[model samples]
Every structure is written in structure tokens, then in C-alpha cells.
Target: MNTASSDQFNEYASIYEDMSQWPFRKYIEIPSVFQEIGDVDGLSILDFGCGTGMYARWLKQRGAGQVVGYDLTEGMLNYARRRAEKEDLDISFVSHLGPELIGQFDLVLGVYVLPYATTRPELQAMCADMVRLMRPGGRLLTLPIHPVYDPHPNYYEPYGFRLIAEDPENPYADGERVKLELCKNGEQGGVFAWYWSATSLERALEQAGLRSLKWRELSASAYPDANQAPKELHAYLQRPHSIIIEGVRG
Candidate 1:
């Protein structure tokens, strides 16, 4: 991670957890992720780039056999550990991953992790790391900028955030820069991410030995609270800004 990105996460770590509760995340992103993840009971799962470790704790509470939260930001990891302790969850929070983690997990959940790859090489290495941690036939689920991302940054404002592309004219160009804007505690904050075409993302995963590449749009109906969710949420789902990518480590 770049120094600026690291510093951004560390500085905003306190307000970061609120993101998990963002309208889109709660109604669409979260549901879409967990629905495809299916049964986690007795599954070994890794929450890569686990921001505040919300997913990590949730996985353990849901009966995941072994759950580990890994990230590069210390501030977030610190809060994650503290929360885990309070919940009396026996989840492990690691600051880094090594070869020891290879093939150690049955499922790897990398929510909003891939866009951090600022370059094609970085994307490839990140994919390699993801594939490295999964046992054979283990599945991977991740989210990245949708190839058909809405060009108007504010289109998702109703969802509490928006993404701006560095090259508006060529927003979907591989490795393009993108900015995510959000507000927390009445303060505005943002993070820089990259855009990877579906093709480029697939190539990286395939080269890393992940098979059965599949791309799908986020479905609001997958949400546990779908019935009560505002009908408007489906609009964002229809014009999704990010998409889900599923694969198996072969």
C-alpha cells in the first residue's frame, strides 16, 4: 500500500466501521456478498483487507470454523482486535500474510480489496496473494469497480457515496484512477482506488490459478432485509458501480 493510502486508513480508522453500515453496503453490497458465500458453518474463512474486522467477527459468530482478519492498516487492526476481545470471539487478527497461510482457508472474502491495486502488476500480485491463501477448490469472492461503472460520480450519492474516475472520458480503461467519497461524523473523507476492466481482472485471477471465473451484479434481493428495504435501493443495484467476481483456486 502507498504511504498516502496507509495514512488515510489509519487516520480514518475510527469512523471506518460506520462504512459497513452504509446504506448500499447494508442493503446491497453485504447481502450480495453473503448470499453468494452461502453456508459458512465450519468453514475456514479469511477476511482480507478487513477494514474494522466487522466481517471477521460476523464470520465467527456465524460459526465459521476458523476466522482470521488480515490488513495493512494498524489502526483498523487495533480496533478489530479490541472489538473481537469485547465480543469474546476467538478470531485472530493478523497484520500481514505469509507462506504459512497458503492453502489454509476454505473461503477468502476480499471485500473492496482489488481496487487498491494501482497498477496491473499490483493487481496481479494481489490476485496471486488471494489464490495463495485458498485450499484447492476453495472459493474466492471479491468486489471491484464495475466495467460499466456509471460515469456520473454523483449517481450513487443516494447510497451515501460516489466514485470519480481520473479519466472521465475513458472511465473503464484498465488501471484508471478512481476516487471514493464518503462522509462520517459530519466530516467528508475519501479514498483512492483503481479501475480494472473485467477482462483485466479475470486474466490476473486466471494467471494466479483461480478458475471458474464468474462475474455477477449485486442483487438487492439477496439482502436479508430486502423485503423492508427501500425500493430505491434497486436502482443502484440495477446500475451497479461495483460488481462481484467469483472464482475457485484450482
Candidate 2:
């Protein structure tokens, strides 16, 4: 990740927990993420790019064995560590990709992590990192911007964030810059990330020693709060802004 990206997320660290409370994330994204993760009981796991330790804590509480969270921003890592301490969760939070974490996890999960790679080589390195962290036969479950995300930035404003195409004329071009505007309850901030085409994403994972790559659409209807979700949820689901990709280490 670039300095600008780290600096941007450091600023967001203070409000990251609040943003995680957005209704879409609460009612849809969370369930979708966990559904793909499946049973974590006794499984050693790595929460790659685990901002705020949200999923790491949850995974630990759900019986994941030795859950560890890794990220690039110290601000984010500090928040995650503090939260883990407060919650009495024994998860480890680290900022570096050291040898200690390699080939040690039964599963590697990265939520919104791949997008932070601002270049294809960075993306490739990240995918390779995920593979390195996982033990043989371990799985990877990650979320990245949907290949068909809505080009209109404001379309998702109602849900507390916006996805702006950095290049308005060519939003979906491979490796194009995409700006994310996160807002809610009078607090707001934004960040820049790059978009990856489905082909590139798959190839990155495959080249990094992962196999059986699959993409699944997140459905608000599958959430337990589906009935309580507002009408806009259907539209969000129709043209989902994020997607799930899972594979096993070969």
C-alpha cells in the first residue's frame, strides 16, 4: 500500500468502527462474509487487512483457533489491538508480513483488503501473501469491489457510502482508480483504491497457488434481516457493489 493510502486509513481509523455499523454492512455484508467463511471452530485463521479487528474478534469468539489480524496501517492495528483487549479476545494484531505468519493459518480471510492494492503488482503480491499465510489445503475467502459495481457514485449514498469512478469516462477499465466515499450520521471521509477486472483477479489468485476460484453475489435477501431491510436493498443486491471470491490453497 502507498503512503497516501495508509495516511487516508489512519484518518479513518477513529471512525472505522462507526462506519462498520452502516445498515448495509449490518444486514447484508456481515452475513455474506461469514457465510462464505463457514465453520471456524478450531481453525487457525488470518484476518488479512483486518481493520478495527471486527471480524477477527468475531472469529475468535466463534471458536477460531489462534486468530490473527494483519494490516498496513498502525492506526488501524492499534484500534484493533485496543478493541481486542477491551473485548478480552486473544487475537494478535500485526502490521508486517513477517515469516512468523507464513504457512500458519488454516484459513485466510481478507475483507476489503484487495482493493487497497493500487497497482496490479501490488495486487499480485497481496494475493501471494494470502497464499503464503495459509497452510496447505487452507481456504481463502475475500471481498473485493464487484466487477459490475454501479458507476454512479451517489447511487449508494443512501447506504452511507459512495463509489466514485476516478475516471468517469472509463470507470470499469482494468486497474482503474476508484474512490470510495464513506459517510454516516454527520461523519464522513474517503479513500482511493483500484478496480480489478474479474480475469485479472482470478489470474492473480491462481498464479499465487490458489485454486477453484469462484465468485458469489451477496444477497440482502439471504440476510436474517431481509424482511426489515428497506426497498433500496433490492437495488443494491441487483447490482451489488461488492462480491465474494473463495478458493483453496493448492
Candidate 3:
């Protein structure tokens, strides 16, 4: 894995929260996923790729017994620490991969992280490792980029690729457009992103020995913006911008 790419997130660590809640409004399905998982009270939760502890904070607010936030980036950890301190949250932040980490949890979450993996094999390995961290019957929930979207024109610009389908009828149909751009500040060239489809993700999870409990395509329509959103965002909102998958570790 490219440790540098993992660490690059630290650069934006401090303001990561502000970036999302503000103009981007890149709503991740953390709260909804938690609701679906149901009653985390007295359960230990692990937030894999818990960038800046956004969801961790949410978990704390919702009354989890213990919430551990893990990230490969030190920068993100630094900001996460500060955020936790500011909020007086007692969450623990671990700077390690799933395999390297110890202990088990009742619930594990990977929100907006797997797609950033350097390779498919790494993603698979990470999924396996995540399952390993869960106790039997524990739940592993993740939101990965829907593969139903159009393929990227170029491999390097995985994040920059847009969804080409106009009206997607099913998870297999392509309806929304997505653009992911990863570049170094002031540097014209840097490492790029890779995309994943839902089928590929399911295969990885199946290989990891996780049994799918539920799967769904989530878009803005699932929320309040069903009627009013820009054409691009509207299409993505109607089509699935993300695939929410819940599996039980057996």
C-alpha cells in the first residue's frame, strides 16, 4: 500500500469536518447505517478510516460504550485528537491498519475509505482484516462507490470520472455521474485514484467470509434533496452515488 497516499489525508485533517459540513455537503450515510444496525448502546464500535473522527463524534453522541477511530494518516489523527479534545469525546484514535490493530468490536464501519485503496487486492485484504476485528455475529458495514456507474475514461483519473447513464432503473443501471480528483497541492502530477463496482466489492466481501445481511443503493433521493438538486447532483442523487452493504461476521 502507498503509505504516503494514506498519509496525505493528514494535510486536510484539521479542516476536514468544516470541508464536508459546509459547501461540499458530502453526506456520508453514517447515521442511517447506524440506525439500520440498530441500538449500538453498550456496544464497542470501530470506525475504520475514521477521517477527522466525524462519524466517531456521531457515535459518541449516540451513546456507544466505546468508539475507536483508526486511520493510516497521522495528519488526520492529529486533527482527530484535537477534535475529540474539543468535544470532550473519549474516543480512542489508532494509527494502524485493521490487521495490525488488536481487540474486537461489536460493530465496524468503513465509510468512504475502501475506494481510496491503492489496489483491489489491498481492498480485499483490508476487508478480510476488518472482518477479523469483529466478533462472531458482529456487523461490518461499509459504503463503497457503486460499480453500476460508467467506467472511467482513464484509470489514473478514477475520481474524476463521471457517471454517464441518464436514467438508472436498478443498481445495475448507470444513472449518476461521479468525479474523484486526487492531486498534490501545487504539484501538477501525483498519484491517482481507482474505481470499484458493486459486483467487485461483493466478491471481495464474500471472499472475506462475510454474509450479506442487506445491500442498497443510496442517493440524494433517499434524503430531503429528492426534488431540488443540480442536474449533476440530481442525477447522482437519484441514481446510486454509493452502495451501502451490511454483513455479519460468521
Candidate 4:
């Protein structure tokens, strides 16, 4: 992970939880994330790049036997530990992603974590590390920026952010960067992230000895109030803002 990017996440740690309530997350990302999770009961799970351990806590509540949340940011880890302590949840949050974290989990997952890999080596290292931390037959799930995503207003409008593509004609051409301008209550902030194509992601998984790969795009149907959405907005369900990749350790 890039040092500057890590710092940025630390700086945004306070607002991170609030962003979880963003329209896109509630209506699209969360649904898709849980769908990929399915049943975690009795499984020993690992949350890679866990920010504040939200998913870790959720998995524990879902009956996971054990949940370990690993993140590179200390600020996020501190928040995670505090929340878990206050709630009396038996989840562990660590600020390390190291070799000692090998072969101990039945399932490993991360939401919007891969974009932190700012280089090819970093990306490959992340995939390798994820597989190393999983047992044989253990599943790995990740939600990453969709290679096919575009700045279509109909879909992104409700999220209070505008996507500015550096290369409009070929924004999804593997390694492209997307700039995000976030708006909330008239305040604005900007950030950017990298996107990896499905092909590249698959290769990384394969190199890590994970197989039976599958991809699921984010959909509005994952939302609790999906049925109440206007008919015209149903089209947004088909246009994914993120992609979920799942595979099993070989």
C-alpha cells in the first residue's frame, strides 16, 4: 500500500463509518457484499484490509466461529478495537498483514480493499498474502472497483459523488485512475483510486493458488427498500458500480 494512501484512509477514518450510509453503499455495495458472504456460521473468517472492523463484527454476529480483522492503518484498528470492546464482541483487529497470518481461516473477505494496491507488485502481493492466510478449500471474496464502471449519472447521482475519468474513452482499460469528488450537505472532498480488470484479478488469484473464480456485479436489489425504488431506477441495478470476485484456495 502507498504510504500517502494509507495516511489518507487514516485521515478519513472519522468519516468512514458515516460513508457506509451513503446511498450507493446501502442500495448497492452492502447487498452485493453480503450476498457474496452467504453463510459464515462456524467458519473462521479473516477480514483483509478491515476498516474499523464493521464486517468483522457483522460476521461474528452471523455466527462465525472466529473473526480476525487485519488492516494497515492504526487509526482504523484503534476504532475497531474500541467498538468491539464496547459491544463485547470477541473479534480481533490487527494492524499487520504479514507471513505469520498464514493458513488459519475458512473464509477471507475484503470490501473495496484492492484499490489500495497502487502498483502491480503491491496488487500481486495482496493476492498472494490473502491465499496464504486461508486454509485449503477456504473461500476468498473481494469487492473491488468494477472494470466496466462508467460515470453514468443515473446510477451515481444518488451517491453524492461525481466520477471524473482521466481517459474518458478508455477509462476501464486496466490500470486507469478514477477521480471522485464527494459531496455532502454542500461540502466537497476529492479522492482517486485505481481499477483492475477482471483478467488481471483472475491472474492474481490463479497465481495465488485460488480457483473456481466468479464475479458478481453490485445491484440495487440488495437494499432492504429495493422494492420501493422508482421503476426507472431499476436500470441502475444492472449497471454495477463495483464487482465481487470469489474463489477457493487450491
Candidate 5:
């Protein structure tokens, strides 16, 4: 875990939900992708980077035997813990990364976590840790930012996506640089974001020694009530937001 990313998230913790509108997190993204991975009944599940415990709660509702949530930001975990307590859900929250905190689980989920990784090696290491914590035949599911618009210039414009490449390579090794456009009050501004194409993500997973089960482009339209969402939010969803990947430890 990078201290820089952790510090950034910690600062964002108090207003993270407000900034992200995380209350609707599950509703705005891929649910079918999770279903396609198969029934999770009686399986131990881990929700990696589980902000506010939405996925952890969802997993329990889906019949997971036990659900554990882990994140780097203590503030996020604080909110998650409160939510779990209110719901009376038996979910455990951890502030650490890697297998030591996770142990073995039948299923693991990483939602919108990869893009936040600061470097290619960091992403690869996280993937490896996920695999290490899974039992053989146990599945790993991740939703990563699509490579297409990563480091994109227009924060409000739609970013298309492409399939991840299988070959491994360093995502940040070349001196390639791109400006990231951010929106504040509908105003566009630039920031630096490391770009990772689908290929970069796949390479990291392969380097972790996980076997791919399925890979697909996921859109918000695939979810129930997608059409009924606010027009602005619906449009954002239609644009490539993320890619869903399912793999298993060999």
C-alpha cells in the first residue's frame, strides 16, 4: 500500500461518500457481472477496498457464509463499521492489505480499486495478495477503470473501453505522460493520473498466477432500473465506466 494514496484517501474520507454519492454505488454499476460468476452461498467472501461496506452488505444479502471488508482508509472503515453495526450484519473490517489480514476466502471482490493504485507493481502486488488469500478454485472478481479514457482530458465526456491485453508489461515504466481532467462544479481542470490499459491490468493478473474465467465490458444499462436513474447519472453509466474481470487461483 502506498502511503501517498492512503493519505489522500484519509483526507477524502469524511466527504468521500458525499463526493462519490456512494449510497447508490451498487445500483449504478454491474450487478449481473457478479451474478454470472455464480452463486456465492455458503462461501466466505472478502470485499477489498469496501468503501462504506455496500458490497459487503450486498454479499451477505446474497447468501455469502461470511463477509469481510478491508480498506486502507480508516475513515472509510469507520463509516463501514457504523453501517454494519446499524444493520446488525456480522461483517469484519480491517485497515491492512495483503493475505495476513484476509486469510482464505472462497470469493473476493475488488470494486473500482485498480485505478487508485499508484503504480503497475503496486497493482500486481495487490492482485497477488488477493490470489494468495483465496482457496484453490476460489474466485476473484475485480472492477477496474477501463484503460480507454484513463488519463483522459475531458472529465465530463464519455470514455470508451477496450479488452485487456494478456501480456505483462510495466504501465508506468515509459515516460509517457497524460493530463487528467477533473470537474469541480461542472468546470474542467487537469490533474495527473497514471494510465493503465486493459492490457496492463491483465498482465498484472497473469503475473499474479491467476487463471482467467471471464472478461467483459460492463455498462450501467445492464443493471435493473438503469434507465430510471437520473439522466446525468445514466449518461455517465452508458459511457465505459469500468471492466469486470473474473479469475481463479490455480
Candidate 6:
């Protein structure tokens, strides 16, 4: 990971676990990821780029046989480890993934991971790592920022977030960087992430030997009490806030 991105998330570690429960993540991101993942009973799973191990814990709660969480940021890994210890959940949260992890998982999933790649080579390497960790026929699922999303200055208001184009000049041209500013009831924090189009992502995955790419939009109905969700999120019912990418190692 690049220094700036790493620092951003490392700084975010202290607040990530709490911030994650915000409506957007609780309603949209988590549900969408689980929908794509379906069932995990008795499966060995990897939570790639797992920040604070929230999904890893969820997997264990849902009866996954084994779960390993990996993150580049030390703070994130520490927080994840602390949580695992507190709950006595049998999860291994590691700072890195080495050769020993290759082909170790039946299901590998990442949330908001790919956009951290920052460059074509980085993105390709990230895909290669994900494919490397999966057993043949094992699945790879990811939830990432929608590539085609055009951020309007105030469009994110309903979600209590803002997206600013750091380099307005030539922004949204594949692999460009975008800044995501988070806010909830007046508190503020944010992170920088790379932008990747669907076409480019597919090419990278194919290059890494993953096949049968399937794209699914995040659904509002997937959220709990969908009818009670804010009107701002209603817009996402028509337009996507994020997407689920599912593929298989063959």
C-alpha cells in the first residue's frame, strides 16, 4: 500500500469499529457483501484487507469453520486482534499474508479493498494475491466503490459522507484517486481511495486467473428495516452506492 493510503487507514483504526456501524455501512455495505457471499457454514474464509475484523467476527458467529483476517495497517490488525481476544473468537488477524497462506481459503472476501491499489500494477498485484489465496473453485467476493459513480458535491449528504476529486483535472479517468470524507452527526474523518472501472477490474482479475465474473448492485432491500432507511438512501435503490463483484478461481 502507498504511504498516504496506509497512513489514512492507520489513523482511522481507532474510530473504524465505531464508525462502521453508521447507517451506510450497516445498511448498505455489510448487507451487500453478505448477499454475495451467501452461506459460510463450515468454510475456511479469509477476510482480505479486513479493517478491525468486523466481518471475520461475523463469519465466526455464522458458523464458519475457520477465519483468518489480514490487513496491511498495524493499527487495524491490532484492533482486530483485541476484538478477537475480547470475544474469544477463534480468528487469526495478521498484518500480512505470506506464501503459507496460498490456497488456504475456500472463500476470500474484501470490502473496500481494491480501491486502495492506487496504480495498475498495484491493482493487478492485489488481484493476484486474492486469487493466490483461494483453492481451485473457491470464490472471491469484493465490495468496492462503483467505478462509474460521478460524485456530485452534495450527493452524499444523505449518507453523511462526501467525495472530493483531489485532482479535478482528469478525475475519474481510470485509476484516479478520490478522497472520501466521512461525517456522522457533525463528527468528521475521511480516507483516500483509488478509482477503478469495471472493464479494467475485469481485465486485472482475468490476468490473475479468476473467471466467471458476476456483477451485482447493492440492494436496499438487503438492508434491515429497509422501509425505515433514510430517503437519501432511497436514491441508491435506483442508483448504486457500491457494487459486489463475485468470481471464481478455476
lDDT winner: 2
The regions of model 4 sitting more than 4 angstroms off are 152-155, 221-235
lDDT (CA) for every model shown?
0.85, 0.86, 0.66, 0.78, 0.65, 0.82
lDDT of 5: 0.65
**Could you give candidate 4's per-residue lDDT for residues 1-250 as a string of tens digits?**
6667666677556567677777667767776688778888899999998888888988998899989999888888888899999999999898776666689999999787787677777788889988999999999999887777765533565566666667877777676777766665454566677778888888988998999998876767644565576554455565656788999999
Tens-place lDDT digits, model 5, residues 1-250? 4656655455444444443443123444545456555787888988888877777887887788878898887878888899889988999998775445445888888876776666778888878877777888888898876555323234334322122222224333322333334343343333233446667778888888789657765545444666776666664565554667889888
lDDT of 2 by residue, 14-96 (tens): 67777667767876788888877888999999999898888999999999999999888888998999989998999989888
RMSD of 3: 6.1
Cα RMSD to the true fold for all candidates: 2.1, 1.8, 6.1, 2.5, 5.7, 2.2
Preferred candidate (lDDT higher): 1 or 6: 1
Model 2 CA deviation exceeding 4 Å by range: 221-229
- For model 2 the local lDDT of residue 165 reads 89
Rate residue 176 of model 4 by lDDT.
73
Provide TM-scores for the models. Answer: 0.93, 0.95, 0.75, 0.89, 0.75, 0.92
Considering only N, C-alpha and C atoms within 3 Å, which residue pairs clash in candidate 4? none
Alpha carbon RMSD to native, model 2 = 1.8
> What is the number of residue pairs that collide in model 4?
0
List the candidates ranked by TM-score, beginning with the highest: 2, 1, 6, 4, 3, 5
Candidate maximizing TM-score? 2
- Model 4 scores what on Cα lDDT? 0.78
TM-score of candidate 4 against the unseen true structure: 0.89
